[model samples]
Target: MSQKSQNQRPDEQPEEPKADDVADSSGTRAAEPAPAQDEAADEVAPADAATVPTGTDGPVEGPGTADGAPGDRDPAGRDALDRALTDDMNFRTPDEIRSGDATQYPAHEASAAPEDDRPSAEAPPEPDAARDREPETAASLTADRLLDARDRAPVAGWRRWLYRATLGRVNVGDSDAVRLRRLRENSIKTPLTGGTRYVTVLSRKGGVGKTTATTLLGMALAEVREDRVAALDANPDRGTLSDRSPGQTRYTARQLVQNRYLVDSFAKISQYASRQGSRLHVLASDTDPHVAEAFDDADYRAVTDLMGKFYSIVLTDSGTGMVHSVMQGSLEKSDVVVLVSGASVDEARLASETLSWLEAHGRQDLARNAIVVINQSAGLARGVNVDEIEAHFSSRVDSVVRLPYDAHLAEGSEVSLDRLRPATREAVMELASLVVDELRGTR
Candidate 1:
């Protein structure tokens, strides 16, 4: 058969003949449709019928298949897709959809359900009342409360005066007063845990204020910290650390070393050392220069170990020699180092050289982290650059702080924070703060 005749669809196939029309010579039966009937049947088939398969390997009978039994079609299959594309259902007006009149679109008969069970088209439900309500805000939630916490107390200094002047109210502290009060609180609030922390004040040259720095630093720290703070004159030479504090006892560090076995409590330790007020206690060096030179590393170990039991922090005023045996013991126990220098060129160079020596030695880390304090004992020298000195040391050290000359400090009498000038006090407070911060970090 020709390809055109072979491609005719099964539905358009010609009907078989009756047995009478197919009678043969030996009474055999043959069946065939008339040529006129085959031609007429082919004429009625549509061109799109080319898509329909005619062999045994034809498309399987399934939902929507042309040859699929109507009873076998999936009843749940949706005709919305076909109606949307081929029928006028997509062109329906909103009013027609809301009216629910299916009879208006007879072309959508494929989608007609025996029982209309779709949910009624209605507006969305009103949002739940609770969900629609406004959320509680931070201010609204806190409106009823009367207290608020702070890391530090509020200021009361000038604020009080301002309120009194404007609103005729008193007892309101100003910001400055609050700030100073908080600073005072923070200075003294050192926690009483961990092993004793040691701060050593050292200088390679004498008269550069090593002992002075040690005494004042101890005073500042002791005044603020409630815990026990001590200044130890670790100078192998007769030192003046005790003169900075009230000399209550004739016993020196040597006496403490000899009597270390008996020095167990603060009471016993107080016998050899003198207390400056309540917080700071001072252990004086040997008064006789000849005997002070004999105070070696062994004596240092004995004294500090005994003091460590009673003090939270110990400020050692080391001698004017880095190679001194006492300095060895001081550096060994020191957690922080305060390198003291004068504003003079000679003194500053000496201090820098001392740091270099420390670096050359095994204490490079300590030297790098050490605090450099330039004491302005006398007036500034002519043609001497103090800022350059400060900058130079600052680059080599963790921090460099300048100590301004105060009449009280110049006198070298018993060091007291109140006796010092306001600027002097501020500088010391800053130094104490840096040390406290360092302590916190190490812990």
Candidate 2:
């Protein structure tokens, strides 16, 4: 404040700051203010532009800011008029500055130490850039390499030549069809989690390709999966499951049952099983009528118990006779049931009745979750509408698959995936996928 305003004011406007009052001899505002900041201006001398005393006759030096230096202000005086100084800091705090009475901001340090150099408890410390950083992980470091690298290398056709010619820079991926084939193969290759899973192939009548369907289903699963797979010809009558394989073992399901303890391991079980080129194991029932006729649930429990220890999956080729004792155990132990039907009306009717029998006999759970296979292995559908049969079964079951006729399958010889028609192989693949879906559904 200037002298004229001090004496002339009761309720008067303050005088404008003179240029000399805001600056010092060096033209900076870092200099101290008047010794008695509230003293009348006339008592202070203005001759050499030096210090002035307040209550004494002589002048004395002023106290310093908290950090031992006076703060600089805008030369235009906006900051000088509005700013108030406090104990801790006079300038250079990050934000949230506190203002109070510390106007004696001399350019020199006071002999005494500051009350607290640590900082006020309410004001946060200025953050350190290095202190708040997160550590790097392995995934973060390899992210670019993983994203930019090629997952697959072209092996067949001109795609291989183009990749080699460009020094492996230019690349094109596999066709959508090949990708779909890969995905389909992967779907069936899903791991079988629990102990051995059982799948039963059933039909109310024989000759609807029920036996052929079992052979194909076993082959499809065994072709890709590394786990042990067995198809049991537990058909109450002589089952031909072993005949579909290129070679046959002399031992039968009867031998496996009677000598169950001998087949304690898969190596020993191999004596009774006919191992196929597709990696499928066929455990056939006796060709003798009297022995097959006597195969019952007690025999079934013994056979399955031994098979379960060695195989990851067991498929039972059940007979048309629902009254057969083996059929009861097959249905009871089965995780999935494949009900086979031909493309004829009578075959469809008989198969549908078998499904109804399952529902009526307190196995409604199996009926609802059953997979129906419409066997078109006859190579002709001249007079019947196969669509109606499929739709009928579709309403009652979880899924339905159609098997088209293959020339090799019709020959009643050893089955080979390479020999089957593409349509036939595809139908079997879809059926395998559905069976796998059912196995997972059981979990």
Candidate 3:
């Protein structure tokens, strides 16, 4: 046979044919016996026979192969396959894949982006510049703040009149003559009574007419009710109460506060009480300030307890100082509290602060029992307005007693029912009547 025929020919066989040869021979067709067997043998080789590609469009070379054993390719092609595999497996966009090395894969199907980047849902909201930059509205300012500021501001003209309406005149003013005329016109010819009513004037602030108002109120209460009344200057400072009274008296309120034993003797107590004729008594403060300070809470309580029993009304002139525990105790125990303040802005602001302090210290009930009396001591023709003054106080002003400026009243002259100016006297009388009604209801 020729070489071509030899290449295509079947292998020689034994006379007794093997089982494998017989099976192979039967399976192969006559036309392609040898070639078919070779192809079958190639397919049966291990997976490692084919290597990863290197260079471009070629199998990757194995360790010792120059052009590489089977599949070989350039670095570019290898990188492309890596990128394609990453894209298919990771679902990353083509743009992201092309940007750099494709070593990492994107996670599959993440949820939509959150509104804020912060991890916490409870983060505080950021302020908007537009809203913050807007001008403040009238409602932004509180009534209390406005009133407090107003009390500090100075007054002019009609403002002065307004001040007088709330705070009665502390010192003699332009209206003194007119006030006197009014008092003379309004004077009643009623006879004085021996039944006395006592009152106590007090304030946390100095120069707010605590002493002056007490003196004037005592006189007015006596004059209007025709009842016996006394103004006891209980201030340890030995203030102006005695100077306001016309009668001469040696014994003072200090003596009574210090000597509880003496309080038992009506005669001894009477000796201390300054007689201002039929309806009024004046218990002046001691001239020595240190002596006044010597009295304590027990002494004050003893004196008041004794006096309360005897006098129908006892008016105490507590001085303006925060250090006096006895006076503060007396205020707490009193039937009513008269919180005096001037029309000036400082006085009003201070009054409000003091009232707030009192309320904060579980003294709301005490504050409720208080009556605000505005003292217009400076006598400005037109002073702080009544409404304005009320605006400054934490508590309500129960009444606006307008005591006009009266030189005669301040002069410390002889005591006479006719001496008080009309406007001042009428206002005081009205106050006295109010007090009477209040006391009567309590009784």
Candidate 4:
């Protein structure tokens, strides 16, 4: 009703007070400002008071308004304005903010704070001058780089040990003469224990050069060493040795066994012995096959014992038959036994069976002395692989001798060492070498 009311026309009569305003009896103004024009214009305005501020301090601040400078609000608004300012100082740009929002709120005065608390934008790089002046040494490099020049670098612990064990340690030094001399002295100093003088050549199956090994071994010792070497044919089917060495003396083993007293004297027995070569004597088997059965254990012992006195090496050619009393006696007195077998699977199998039989008959000690010789007769048979045969025998093979099946040698004719081919002669010589090394302990 005052002058302000008189000026207003009816058409201009103030619109009904907005919902934010209401009359109060005190006369002091009390009204809520209308909501933002944009908010009011849209009917679907948000209900949260935090989102839309009220009252007439221009527009009440929003979250975005916190970026403004301080001292911009009324004293009554200081608390909330100060808090909002603090939040704004802490708030980071999109690029600066970590995704999880883990940063602590900053103090309201952070923007005005000293430079010491904040990090510098640019930092100096490492100095090349300092690095160039530093000392360089092998220790400075990594271990891998240090060994890069080696052909094969050693590994650590078990891996290194395993490698060295698989392929034996490489010896880089030359053999010394002093070491060789010492080895020879050690061998010579060890005396012989007067071992059994008997020698055996055995083949479970025939035609594997067993007879040839026995004969040639005797011939070698006699011809090469000038030692008294005697060859005894114990084959039940006697005459194999004499048949192989034609024109050999006709003195038979049957004659010696017949006269037991003559076995004691080597000079008296020398007449009955047929000289094959220099000192090689043949105590040929009886011309009669049944004579082997006629001789007993005593005859075998007497012949071996008496012969041992005069002969350094006594070679026995055993037949492929089961053990007879005479054969057992001969095997018992033998110092070394030679088992001969061919490369054929059948020969190997039979040899294995024969070895088992010898072991069962308490002749394992003799079996240990057995040496397997692979005879390549006629040169047609495949060269026998010693390793494969050893697998069947369950022991290391001693030697392999290949005899070229010569027509002259096969006939009942006298064949001298010179008559053989060089290769054949070398093979025989190798066998001789093995035998001499084993019996005489000579290389």
Candidate 5:
């Protein structure tokens, strides 16, 4: 041994092994720390054994200490190379390295670990309800048992189109407009009660579409309602009401009066009436002026009383003259009165005056509940304001429906209910709907 070695202290050790020799003894290929959770452990590799000398500042490297991970703190003595490699590593406390504190880890790794932001599960807050409610079981069931199912087939519009395009793979509900239209149809189909309902259509002036309004109201009501509807022509003048319909009988209201007692069944009464379609039966008045003039209040009552037995609804097309006996009979029995008017100013004034006349007479309730229809309107012609007419009547009456001038109706020929324009049909239905609501309300 050298002189310096012989004089060494008891704690002092001989020269440490070379890095390669240290690796061979530790069973590691290089004098590098084994892989650990912390990169700091692998960073400080052992220095060359030959370059190190006996030292009292720190302990010497033992069996596995040279290659031991810095993150570990085992019974084996720690490597001596960390002191010599102090200049190579970032500054950190020895206690920090020994305990493997978060500070000892790499800058990016320590920052990459996320801090938990969730509230602790312990001492959870109380539930909003009295106690915890278990989840509902209905959601797990199939949709077929529900009223409006999520998987129901589409009926109209873009959803229906998409469903068809995809061979029914896609499904959705009908559009809002279609749904509302269906609701309207269903509303019109509402059943009537309290025996038969009597509806009368009249106007103070001639050529105001009174007969046409009567036909439309009867047709619209009969189209959806599952009951027979009858339209009676009580015009004092020779009525062209039958000419507006496709089916007409040579028999007039006079037949119903003469055969009143014999008309015990619908088959007998159907002879005096001409059925326009499946449900609307039109009872025409005499075509001759002198003959129609003779058809009076007794005749009107006879016809209505007989038809009322077979028909659930009877619409009276009253004469322009309010003082006509048939008109009086109509007003007397009418559950709902419809006052038809033209869009012109004179026509509107006449309609309003006719309402006033009703109020002055013993028929104030009839006038108050009457539905006013402004018809044959071609929009803003001859300085006429249809909207103003509608508004005025709306305030005085139960409802006002504007029948826009449709080309098919303008021809004044036989009327086809389905051939009317959409706007005209909608107006007609609106009037019918109002009449139905009034009938049901009066009941």
Candidate 6:
């Protein structure tokens, strides 16, 4: 049995015991052979023990086996299969076992906590009333320097005797005191905010002043707007804006739409409007043209939503029947469209075909924001061209004014902005400063 291990070659005879190389004897530890690998290490097989050879001396140690080491355990019964896979592995180290990595498990490193016992993660402390707050800029988001010092204009004993007879160079070279200081800075600048504008004088044709430009633009925006301005004849027929502000209220707007929930505030809808001068509120129409043709469109949206909860400039007038049923609540509550037109050539071809029927009805932005006034009723008429009707409504309009023939707005009766004449009250204060500079350039 010893000739050199008796010249051994029945296939060299050493690997025969493998049913996991059985050894237990109720005590275990026997099968240990495979170790010698490092001939510069990688004959490549450790992808978690490619078909498992973990530590029959070559790879497995403590991270229960299939390669992730921790050091000692092989003898082929595989340390009772590394104590039954160390109750299912994940024990790592020997440089995370020949670099195959991913083994961090003691309940995942105590849930990876330690950044100085981390609780905060930063962003909380802000509101001691927003920490003395002062950030919003763009000039404090449009700083509104408290205005409306009620209707300031008493210094006219001829502008305080021409500012003491020219000590102030004829009151700073007054072209009517610089057009009343640009119509009091376009009627005290900021009005249109969120609701109620609806200007709409409108006139497909009816002695075109459209209730005298809605009673002179609601008395020139209630004589320089401190707000609340209305007019609303919405003509159905016998309108004439209650014969132009002939007040003392016979309560029309069809008795405030049949006592619309007792019309709340603005002094109960200024007792069915008509006031005319301390901030012009008219709302007339029902002078019986068969109860003003049964004033429809939900009674003009219940009298303009109860004068839009007390008027921020309504105006309306609206009639000469442009497909009337009270023009469906004045062309869906207008939002600025004066349009009048009586200088002639059939009133500028019916005000350019009513702005080509408001751009064929989808209101092409209310016919491109129409204004087109031209009410020089009879005087501007010797075959009137008035600059080709102001260059054909300034190319279908965002403004074109005119309004001159005033025998006090042509004897329509009650309008008395001190009986208007200083050049028709400076052409209705330059047409209410071009409709309050188109309502502060669209808010």
Best by TM-score: 1
Each candidate structure's count of clashing pairs = 8, 0, 52, 0, 1, 2
Candidate 3 lDDT, 132-242, residue by residue in tens: 895654433543335542443223345456657767433223344444433432332232233433445667788777777776667766555433466666665556776
385-422 per-residue lDDT for model 6 (tens digits): 68888887897776787878878777767777777766
Q: Each prediction's Cα RMSD? A: 12.9, 13.5, 19.7, 22.4, 18.4, 21.7
Predict model 6's lDDT versus the native.
0.67
User: Could you tell me which 10 consecutive residues in candidate 6 have the lowest summed lDDT?
Assistant: 142-151
> Global lDDT for candidate 4?
0.58
- In candidate 6 the C-alpha lDDT for residue 148 amounts to 29
The candidates, ranked best first by lDDT, are: 2, 5, 1, 6, 4, 3
Q: In model 2, where is the ten-residue run with the lowest total lDDT? A: 69-78
Better by TM-score, candidate 6 or 4 = 4
Score candidate 2 by lDDT.
Answer: 0.75
C-alpha positional error of residue 35 in candidate 1 after TM-score superposition, expressed in Å: 16
Task: Show model 2 residue runs off by greater than 4 Å.
Answer: 1-172, 289-293
Predicted structure 5: lDDT: 0.74
| Models ranked on TM-score | 1, 5, 2, 4, 3, 6
lDDT of each: 0.72, 0.75, 0.57, 0.58, 0.74, 0.67
Best candidate, lDDT-wise?
2
Q: Could you give candidate 4's per-residue lDDT for residues 1-443 as a string of tens digits?
A: 12443365545535565434565676556544334442223333224322322224343453323334222233445556557634643664332332434454444444555777566767665579967894644333533334432334234445446456656343222224333433333332232336435677887777776777777667655665534678887766654776665355656776776675756677878766777444678777777644536545676677777677777677888776556666777676766677777667777778767768778888776566566666655344466665666565545444445555555455435546667665666556666655654664421
User: What TM-score would candidate 3 get against the native?
Assistant: 0.50
* Candidate 4 vs 5: which has more TM-score: 5
Candidate 5's residue-wise lDDT over 304-410, tens digit each?
Answer: 88787889899888888688788778888899999988888888899999999999998999999998888864343666767778888888986888898898887
Decide which is better by TM-score, 3 or 5: 5
List the candidate 3 regions with Cα displacement exceeding 4 Å.
1-198, 257-267, 289-293, 381-387, 390-395, 409-417
Q: List model 2 lDDT by residue over 279-361, tens digit each.
A: 89898888875552577788888899889999999999998768888888998899999999999988899999999999899
Residue 259 displacement in candidate 4 (angstroms): 2.3
